[model samples]
Target chain A: MPLEDQLLVERSKKGDREAFEHLVQLYEQKVYTIAYRLMGNHADAADLAQDAFIKIYQALPNFRGDSSFSTWIYHITVNVCRDELRKRQRRPTVSLDDNNSDGNNYTYEIRSTAPGPEEMLDRSETQVMIQQCLDSLNDDYRTILIMREIQELAYEEIAEILGCSLGTVKSRLSRARQALKEKISKQMEPLSPCKRLAK
Target chain B: MRCQDVMELLSPYLDGALATEEREAVRLHVARCPKCSAELEELRACIGMLKELPLIAPPTGFRVGLMEKIDQLPSQQGSSKDKNIFDRVTGIARSSWYRVVAVAAVMAMAVGITSLWEKEGVQFLPLEQKPKGVVAVHEPQKASKEPPVVKEQQPSQVGQSSEPGASGSKSAVNSKGSGVKQPDPQQGNATVPVITEAVKKQVEGYVPKPSTGMAVVSASLRLDVVDIEAALKSVGSIALDNGGTYLGSQDSGSIGIKVPRQSFERVIGALQKLGGVLSYLPTEKDVSVQHQTAKAELERLKAEQGELQTKLTSEPSQELERQLADLNQALLKQIDTMKQLEDRTNHCLINITLQ
Candidate 1:
């Protein structure tokens, strides 16, 4: 833990609301992003992120610094998302329509050197397609994929968060990537034969 | 490497998670094999697309909204230490042993106190000790055989006091002594002392000694407010300003407030100013006896716990250690009850209903 975060956790454990708010500000975006990718919607993601922070605040006192603060937070976020997904499964409410009509407005801004307009448009469409495919996977596979590929967490960290062994993490990540690849490939099958063959 | 082995290692190869030897094997095989190369390239593109997915910025004012929700959480749940205490206290209070013991003890105490007051002809005074105007309603037909003690106390005109207007003092005494049956000590000389001693022992066994006098002040107020939510917020603020807490609100537009005992009246007054007072009922319950009883029990249990601790240190027996553990648990429960009672007495509860 960074000295600043360690101090904040200690103060938060002591019931300092300000300290907790500071901690929330520090990690809210990261936590929200992970939740968004896992949940695939802004509303559920935001709600889950807030819920996770509240849970993290409640569970902070039992935090013994066995893992980094970020790892602990990621663990809590994953659990919150999993629980919400479980609840949705049981209740089976009619989810809102995909509402991807505005998909064109969302462009993937890659960190590499800026691409041309045509390249950017293709990348944006590919990003949205990948997200849709990712959302279609089972909770276990999607969660592992997001934690590894998007959050960029280490295998050890993922294992700790998932409460599995390092070997399990490796196997799960491999399976998750394979599952995602199969989904994307199945979606691309309907496209032109030339595009498919080029790959 | 064969196609199957190459395919199995491709995912890890893309992640750079494979061992160096495995990575080399997959690399060399994919370089020469078009089929395996296509598979690896496809997996790489999928992962790259995932990694390049746009980061969604949280809704605006998320931090503020989260902080507000955190503030709304019960104070006890915000800290693990407080949550532990709350959980343990609720657990003990809900446990069968505690429930049975507490109910039995309270019943026994009530019975003992009633019997004591009857036998000793003790007048139980209200906690406030205020004297009210007496109303005498005559019902001569209901009078039983008057005890000799009563007659002896007013011997001047025993028969002459039969007149309704003249018998005020006698009637008052009769009314006060209505429920008690005075056993004739002379009729059973040998049984009297034994019965009295048995009753005394039973009463003493159940009721712990009372300690300091502490009063719990509670008030209920109904207000006709133009704005219910604003009135509720004002009531909450009043409690906070008076070094207290806004416990919660019910669906019936009633809010529960807790303020320091010393500021109970002040909080009530402030609440009254919030809107037109429709109804206000303020009461004081002297829980001194109950508080003291729990405290005494806690002390006794703690003393026993200390002795058990000493015994364990000297002569370690599994049976003794088990007994010690049970005693310690009981001690913690008693202490929790004492603390709860003390808190209740120190802070007053005010239920405010907004119309």
Candidate 2:
């Protein structure tokens, strides 16, 4: 643990609400980002992030410092997300976006003048397709991929968060990347004609 | 390297998790094999696209919303520790042996209090009266033989002031030196003051400080009521009558009520009158320590905020501005928390469950 975090944890354990609130401020964005990727939606991600912090506050006293505070927090976040997923499975709601075959309409302003509108659209479409593919994977694979590729967490950190060995983390990442590749490739197969014409 | 070998190492190589030798082997093979090289390129493109996915910003007011939720939650110290003690007491109550021990302990306490009250003629005053003083009966010869349990009760006595007379008296000597000497144990007489008048005179030279600790009282009740709505209404009225308000109510026949700490026992008594209580658990948590800790923290933050403000005024840098902003936020949160603790300690919560 960093000396600052250790001090914060000590102060938090001693019922210093400000110390815990500081810890919350420090990790809220990162936690929200991970939750958004895992949950594939903004509202649920925010809910999960709030819940995770509340749980962290309650459980901080018992935090034995066996693992780094970040890892401990990530572990709690993943568990909370998993519990939410399980609950969601019991009473499923149809997502309106699921039927909307049109890609995300949210515009991305390209900073560079190199790419034309058509190329930007294609890239945006591909990005949407990749998200869809990531959503298609099961929670374990998707979580590992998000932690690794997007969040850029180390393998050892991923393993600690996932409660798996380093070898499992490696294999899972490899499998997740392969699965993503397959999905993207399948989505792009129809675009090959458009690609050839664009070329 | 075989094509299959190079293929298995591709992901790790892309991830930079492979050793130098393994990375070199895959590199050399991919350079020689077009199929392996294409696969590696595809893998790299997939990862690159994944990385390019824009980071999602959490909705605005995320921290504010979270802080609100945290504020609504029961403050941390009282709930868990009290729950553990409550659970242990309940557990021990369930076992026969422990129940016997508990009964014995209660009996011993009753006897000790009764004997002391008889000797001192100490009247139990209403909640408003300041504990005048406890008549400390110390026998010099029997001091060494005093039970450790009696010693334990002295601090509680000291914490709660008691006076020497039936009528309220203002004399410090009457309150402080009320300890009477017992000549014989056979007569069951009151004992002498532990400290002699000379010693008390010497001690009187020092200033006396008052106790400022606050106690938080909480109760949880499971009731079998005739009508849930009626019971809830009665509970709400009870709270209102006691200068409290209905904090909230749930559709599931659960209601949260907050009443003044002084009227906590009265509120519980009123609640019991509404229905047959299946379980009534009242706990008093001394959050003086927690309150003091938060006060100290608030003072420290306020000092820091003042220092930061001074620094910002002297050097108008962006870094100082940001730091000041963060410090202000932290200070606000700390003050809010301290205010909440004070409010919570002043009012007791009664979580009533009706069936």
Candidate 3:
């Protein structure tokens, strides 16, 4: 945990509102991205992340210094996102937009001409589809991929976050890498480089 | 350089998570084998692409919004240290400082109130003059420690109201409970109405008709269907066809629905369309007896509140004023719970599971 987070945690234990708020500020993006990877869309991810934060806040007073705050927060977020995924599985699949086959259509593009934001909505949307492809993966595969690639957590740290043996973490990551490779390869076939290379 | 050996090293090499010795071994092996090199490159690209997966930055002010929400939560000071109410009370019991402060506060209030009363020549308040109504119907229900459990069950029961006028205090949530569980509208569609009507008929003769222009109904059912989705659509169409809508649903595949009391049979006929019926859960939950008791208690509280308020104005002692404030708070909490229960019971919550 960062010094700021440690400071916030101490203050929060003493019931300081500002300190808790600062903690939420520091972690919202990281938590949100974890939820986004698992749930696959902006709306569901946002909802899951918010719920996890609420649980984290509620559970803050119970902090026992057993784990780093980041690890604890990650555990809470993954658990929350998992619960959300289960709930979603039970319900009928309803997309907010039906014209697009992919649920990743919910991703908005900032459409700019230069590197600063010039990408077309199509490019942004394709990026969203790639994310959706990532989301369609199984829980074990998705979490390993996200932790290894996006969050860049080491194998040992991931094991701690997931509460699994390091061997299991490594095995899951190997499988996740293979699965993602196959998916991206398949998805990239339509693009120019991949198509030309294939030919 | 067998496939198995290459495979063993692939994960770490692909991740750049390998040690120097392992990295050198894999590098030499891949360099010597075209297939292994191609595989490594592909793995690297795949991992790189996954890393590049467009991270949707959460909406700006996410932290601000989250912090605002955190600030809004009632401080968890009481529950954090103590697991439950018993633990909390025990902690208070064990604390000498808490005991001393509590006793001192009570003594100070008593002396201050007495001196003020003596100075003003105030008379004692008589309880008989308090007005009795729904406000009075609220306390025993509130004090029963029943609200949280009832609130928890409300989502499960909201589809079929077993108790008529049982107000479901669950606000209209787009998702299910306060947990991360999204409110499954599809589940609500399938089970809400069949259970609602069953509860209505159950309460028809057993419960007293509310004198306050309200009705109570209760029913129990076991809906056996092969597919939960098809059942929900069929039941939803039934409610829609009969001019009703779904209220809620349970994980067991039971649904709660609300239809006009007059079209009860139509809703029942619609539910029967939901495929083969197994044994329906019995809605013998007779709130009538409990309802009467709660109504009486609520009336009594209202009367008490009125008496306290009147005494506060007339006698104006600090103790009386504090007591009046306490009574009002209790009364409000009770009313809120009753109103919630009333909403839930108004609709029938049907519990069902498909084999």
Which residues of candidate 3, in runs, are more than 4 Å off?
Answer: A64-68, A86-126, A194-199, B19-22, B60-74, B80-355
Model 1, range B1-355, lDDT digits (tens) per residue?
6899788778778878889898988889999999999988888877877877766566656777788787555432312223355675776576554554454345445545755685686757432342111000011222234332223233243444454533434432343332224322112221322322322232233433345777778888899999988888888889889999888898667899888889987888888999899999989888887777777676687578667656654554547645764564465446546656777787888899999
In model 1 chain A, the worst 10-residue window by lDDT is: A91-100
DockQ of every candidate structure: 0.22, 0.19, 0.19
The candidates' interface RMSDs, in order, read 9.4, 8.6, 8.9
Candidate 1 colliding pairs: none
Cα distance off (Å), candidate 1, residue B9: 1.6
Model 2: residues with Cα > 4 Å off, grouped in runs: A1-11, A63-68, A87-124, A192-199, B19-21, B78-355
Model 1 chain B lDDT-worst window of ten: B130-139
Q: State the C-alpha lDDT per candidate.
A: 0.69, 0.67, 0.60
Q: What is the lDDT of residue B80 in candidate 2?
A: 22
TM-score of each: 0.47, 0.47, 0.46
Weakest 10 consecutive residues, lDDT, candidate 2 chain B?
B186-195
Which structure is stronger by TM-score: 1 or 3? 1
- Candidate 2 residue lDDT tens string, B66-171: 7778656543543322245567567545754444434435655655575567568665533234221212223223323543323223433332334332112112
Question: lDDT per residue, candidate 1, A130-177, as tens digits?
Answer: 777878888889999988887788888888778999889888888888
Give me the displacement of residue A6 in model 2, in angstroms. Answer: 5.7
TM-score of 2: 0.47
